[model samples]
Target: MLAAATALFALVASASAQALPSSAASPEQLALVDAQYNASGFPDSGAILTVSYASFVVQNGNAYTAEQVATAPTIYVTPSTTTRDEFNSSSVYTVMLADASSLGDPDTEGNYRRVLQRSTHYLVNGQTGTSTGSNYTFEPSGGT
Candidate 1:
C-alpha cells in the first residue's frame, strides 16, 4: 500500500508540473496579446521594413530549423516613422517581434527549450492620434 501511494503521488506531481504553464497567464492577458497582433496594421506611407528572426538553438539529440524551433509568444516592434528606405539604405535598423515565456524550458538532451507558448508581440509606429506614418513592408529573402 505504501509503494502504491508513493507512486500515485509522483505521477500527480509530474502531471502538475507539465500543466502549470498552461494556466500561467489569465484570459485577459491572452486577449491583450491577440489584440496587439491584430492592431499592428501599417499606414499608407508605402514604407516597408524587413524582419529577421534569431534566437538560441536547443539541441535535443537532433538539429532543427528556425521554423521547427518552438518560439514563445511573438511581439512585433516597429519604428516610429517610415524606415523602409532608411533600413534598406543604411542597413542599420529593422523591425522586430518576440514571443517570450516566463517559464522557459530546456530539452532532454541538456539543451534549452525553444519557445513553446503561443503569446505573440507586435508594434505600430504611431498612436491613433499621431499623424507620423510609419507603414512598412518586409523584403523577404530571395525576393520571395
Candidate 2:
C-alpha cells in the first residue's frame, strides 16, 4: 500500500512538471474569445468559446498529451483561443474545457458540465497571437 501511494505521488508530480498545451490560439484567436465574453456580459463566458486538445505540436519547447493537457483548468492561458466573431463581441475572454475525474471534481458534477476559466491579459488587432501569464482558477463541482 505504501509503495502504491509513493508511485501515485511520483506520477502526479511528474504530470505537473509535464503539463501540456492542446492548441495555440494566437492573439487573433484570443481577441475573438474576448469579444464574445464581453458581449455576453461574461455570462458563463467560457461557454461562448470552444476548446480542445490534440497531440502537442510544439511551442516554446515541450511535448504533451491530451490527458496531460486536460489536467489544467486554464486552457486559454496556455495557448488556446476563439473565432474572430467571438473575439470582437466579447469584453472579457475565457476558455471553456472539460475536466477529468483524476484532476478533480467539476463544479457541475456532470462530466461534460464542467469547465475551466481564463481571463485576457493583452490584445492586438491584425496580430495572430496573445501573451498569457500562468494565471488561472478552477471551480470544482462538489466537496467530494
Candidate number achieving the greatest lDDT relative to the actual structure = 2
Residues 29-107 of candidate 1 have per-residue lDDT tens digits of: 3343334334333122222111222443221123334453334211122222333233332242222233322212334
The total number of steric clashes, by the backbone 3 Å criterion, in model 1 comes to: 19
Instruction: Supply the global lDDT for candidate 2.
Output: 0.27
**TM-score, structure 2 vs. true:** 0.20
RMSD of each: 18.5, 15.2
lDDT of 2 by residue, 54-97 (tens): 53222212333445454322222232343223322123332222
Q: Quote the RMSD, in angstroms, for model 1.
A: 18.5
Per-model TM against the reference = 0.19, 0.20
The local distance difference test score of model 1 is 0.24
What are the lDDT figures for the candidates, one per model? Answer: 0.24, 0.27
